[model samples]
Target: MGLVLAAGAGRRLRPYTDTLPKALVPIDATTTVLDLTLANYAEVGITDVAIVVGYAADAIAGRVNDFQDRYGVTLELVPNDKALTWNNAYSLWCARDLLSQGVMLANGDTVHPASVQRTLLDARGEDRQIILALDTEKSLAEEEMKVIWTSENGVRTITKLMDPAEATGEYIGVTLIEPDAAAALTEALKLTWQRDPNLYYEDGYQLLADQGLRIDVAPIGKVDWVEIDNHDDLARAREIVCPS
Candidate 1:
């Protein structure tokens, strides 16, 4: 199954995000961030998709049929009532029921190619429970969700607060959550949101790592992607997806 967390209110990308969720924001004349996402899932043979929606949920709700028809995938809408008040930790946790199926999880705000999803799917194995798509080749910055990982321990730390110099790479908002890791991840996410509603889902990953979970990393070599948090990011996404 493929799961997408689309609940956050992107306050930074106003006017465009004013009436639409970040996922629904148009990246091109005929494609949206969500559209590209579903298309990617379909490309990877994941026909059952669950999207957690909030903050203009109706907009996404209205597009379910269209998305399903266009991508040849089944759409399941998961509602997050706390979307307005809480962060993505809670939003992701809302889809815990679907995680047991071994989910390919992606952040709805991220715009990337199907190859990123294909990379994680290809790297899946019995030993790998939670695999994050890491961009080891990208230039790190303070804004990027940085990860400090070792070949032995996998991911030691993942947070945006860390210094760019210490990070191995940036987590590019795509992950493979195996069935074995679902229970622990659900618990970790619950604890993360309960401790602080403002925490990101990456905090949950940190909690899992702290608890000795073997979180693996798959390097998405030289991929063009962007998480649309603001106008600049949206512009970059446009350039990546619809370069002219």
Candidate 2:
């Protein structure tokens, strides 16, 4: 399977990124945010990785390439030149040729070993798209881009995180998709982002759900992942990964 690391302007994590990309910011003596995610995937048997780079992509590219050179993994590069303008769906679409069989999509800003393992394990038997959902110590808010399900069945509905119903929790930015679903999602992205240039990947997934696609939410029970949105997130994540 393939993995697409969504690349974009991390406007939320400023100042630190005033000089460096968020993904390249150091977490510890041994890892960066993106490095931890990449290493997690490697541990769980993901060999082929395609990282979509933009928004200070050169550093992301250099760091990942350096690691790949040392570790010998199949690390491919896909550029989201429009990352400044478009959302993550467009990033994955740019790398569709590398995802012919199927692929996993990840948020470059979040990293944790358990979270990576859970996403891969949960997506194992799925025949369709599987979006990773996490329940947490603090409930994810209505603006965090969440996923929810009402079915005794495993299939679910992913919304903009603004729906009144309390979700299991937030998206961990991990999604598994077969090639057909990936193609369908890209097509949906075309329609969704045509009128509005600021569309996110959630927009495409919502389009798929609206059209009756079987999008499964792979629930990861309160796990050890961290989403680096701001300085606090960075500090907290660094503490978790680099408690010295």
Candidate 3:
């Protein structure tokens, strides 16, 4: 099972989202951003999916229902209790029970390239969690997460959003986690929630990796993958996912 983070009001994506749920914002003639993402997941045989939503949860559920009616995919709505002052970590907590031992976690705002699905399917039962990493050989900005891999081997540690000056590339917002690591995520959240429930999943991952948990990177860059945050990204991703 995979968990999709769809909670939180699209504050950055204002006015337009004032009336419509951002997830329902269309990216093509017959698809919205969420539609494109969920449809692609279904295309890859991922039938179990939970989308954590907050503001406009009902409307998002309606969209999910519509998708199920049309595409016949299981896109359940998981409501986040605290979506106001939190990042995506809270959404993960809300969708916790929906996930299985090895779960795929993706941002609802991004349409991950279909090629990344192979990395996820291959990650099942792997020792370390897998992350879709951008090639470090490319010329990236100075503020990227420099990769320090052990070898070309399958197991390694991934430090996210590392110092860009010393980093080589970035994360494409696609990840696959092992069962134990998924359980560890819940444990790490229990510790942090005592202090702050608004923490992001990145914090737990970093902590677990620091504690010597292996985190592997699945290389992907050739396909078109875009993340939509502001209006500009929305426009850009629309073109990539639904090029006419």
Candidate 4:
């Protein structure tokens, strides 16, 4: 199953998000971020997808049929009522019931090619509990969710608090969680939200790592992708989405 966390109000994007969720904002004239996400999953033959919705949920809820018809996939809408007050940890936790099933977690506001999903899915490792899609070639920034890890075997020390200079890669807001890691990840996410409702889902990954869960990374070498957070990012996404 594929899970999309689309609950954030994206206040930084202001006027653009005034009526629509960040996921609904178009990267190009025809394609929105969520459109591309569903397409990515469909390309990988994943049909059943769950989307956590909040912050003008109607915008997305209203278009559910259209999205399903357009993508040839089934979308289960998971509502997060506290989206305006709490962070994405809560939004993720809202879908706890679906944790047992293997899930490909993606942030609804990120835009990337289907190969990002294909690469992570194609990597074979029976022992890896969770796999994160990373962009090792991108320039690190404070805004990016940076990771500092020993690449000896797989990625380690997956967190965003590290200084950009010390980071090994930038997590591109995508993760593949196998069944073995589902329960632990769900517990960690619960603890993270209970401790602080403002924490991000990335904090849950850190907690899992502290408990010795191996959250590995699949570096997307030189891939064109962007997370639309603000107007500047939207501009960059437009360029990446429709390059001349």
Candidate 5:
């Protein structure tokens, strides 16, 4: 199964996101970030998907049948009542029940190809419970979610505050959460949101790592992808997905 965190209110995207959630923002004439997401999941044989929705929940909910029919996948919407007040740590926690199924989690605001999902799924193994898709080839920046990982110990840290020079790569907002790691991750996410409502789901990942969970990384090589947080990112995503 697949899980998507699309609950964030993309205040930076302005008028585009004023009535639509970031995931529902149109990247092309007819395709949305959510559309491409479901397409990507369906491409990799993940036909059952759950989306954590907030902000403009009704926008996505109203399109459930349309999306399911268009993407050849089942769409389930998980509502996050705290979406307007809290961060995505709580949004992600709302779908904790689905985590036990071993989910391929994707951030709904990211625009990328199916290959990124393929990369993570290909790296899955019995010993690997949590696998994050890392973009090691991309140049690091202050706002990107950076990670410090060693081949021997897996991911040591994952946070946007880390120095770009000391990071291994950027976590591209896609992760494979094995069923075995679900309980710990769920608990960590609960603790994260309770500790600070503004914390991201990555913070939950950090907690899992701190608890000695084997958090691994899969390099996505070189790819054209964008996290749509603002207008500039939206443009970049449009170029990546629908360049003329």
Candidate 6:
């Protein structure tokens, strides 16, 4: 299953997000972030996708039938009512039951080619119950969700609170959650949200790692991808996807 977290109201990307959710914002002339995401899943031969929607849920819900027909994939909409008040840890927890079947979870606001999913799916296995895509090439920034790993690739930390200098790579917001770790991961997410409703889902991974869950990192080398958080990022995304 391909799971997408698309609940947040992209306040930074406002006026554009004032009408449509961030995922529905266009990158290419005709393709939106969620469009590319669903296409990636289709390219990988994953036909089932579940999208967690809020903050303009109607926009996404209205497009479901068209997206399914266009991509040849089925979509299940998971509503996150607290999306305006709570962070993504809660948005993710809303799909615990669906995630128990194994999933390639991606952020709906991120735009990446099919190769990103292929790389993660290729590296996942029994031992690596949680696999995250890391961009080793990207320079660290305070806002980027950073990651540190052991020599064996076990994720040591994943959060935005870490100093940029201490990070090994930037998590690009895509992950593979194997069924074996789904229950524990769900519990960890719950704990993270309960502690602070403002925490990102990365905190859930940190909690899981602290409890001895081995989250592996898969470096998406030299890939053209962008997370659309603000206008600057949206500009970069257009260049990445519709470059002359």
Clashes of each: 0, 0, 5, 0, 0, 0
Candidate 5 or 4, higher lDDT: 5
lDDT of each: 0.93, 0.69, 0.66, 0.88, 0.93, 0.92
Clashing pairs in 3: 142-164, 143-164, 144-164, 146-167, 146-168
Model 3 Cα RMSD, 1 decimal: 2.9
Candidate 1 off by > 4 Å: none
Off by over 4 Å in 5: none
Which residue pairs collide in model 4, if any?
A: none
Q: Write the per-residue lDDT of candidate 4 for residues 116-205, one digit (tens) a residue.
A: 998889774868788899898988877889887675545556666778888889999998888888788889999999999999999998
Cα lDDT tens digits for candidate 6, 124-213: 765778889999998888989999988674998988889999988999999999999889989999999999999988999999888887
Model 4 lDDT on a 0 to 1 scale? 0.88
Better of 1 and 2 by TM-score: 1
Q: In model 2, what are the clashing residue pairs, if there are any?
A: none
Regions more than 4 Å wrong, model 2? 136-138, 152-157, 160-165
- The TM-score obtained by model 3 is 0.85
lDDT of 3 by residue, 1-244 (tens): 6667777677778886786656766677687767766766777777777788887778786666678877668777777767766766666766666444566777777776666766666655535554544554455554333455554542333344555555435566667765666666776655655557766565565556666666677667566766676788888887787677
- TM-scores for every predicted model: 0.98, 0.87, 0.85, 0.96, 0.98, 0.97
Model 3 spans with C-alpha error above 4 angstroms: 123-126, 130-139, 142-149, 152-162
lDDT of candidate 3 vs native? 0.66
lDDT at residue 77 of model 3 (Cα atoms): 78
What clash count does candidate 1 reach? 0
| Alpha-carbon RMSD of each model | 0.7, 2.4, 2.9, 1.3, 0.8, 1.1
Candidate 6: C-alpha RMSD to true structure equals 1.1
lDDT of each residue in 90-169, candidate 1, tens digit only: 99999999889999999999999999999998898868999999999988888999999998898999999999999999
**Model 2 vs. true fold: TM:** 0.87
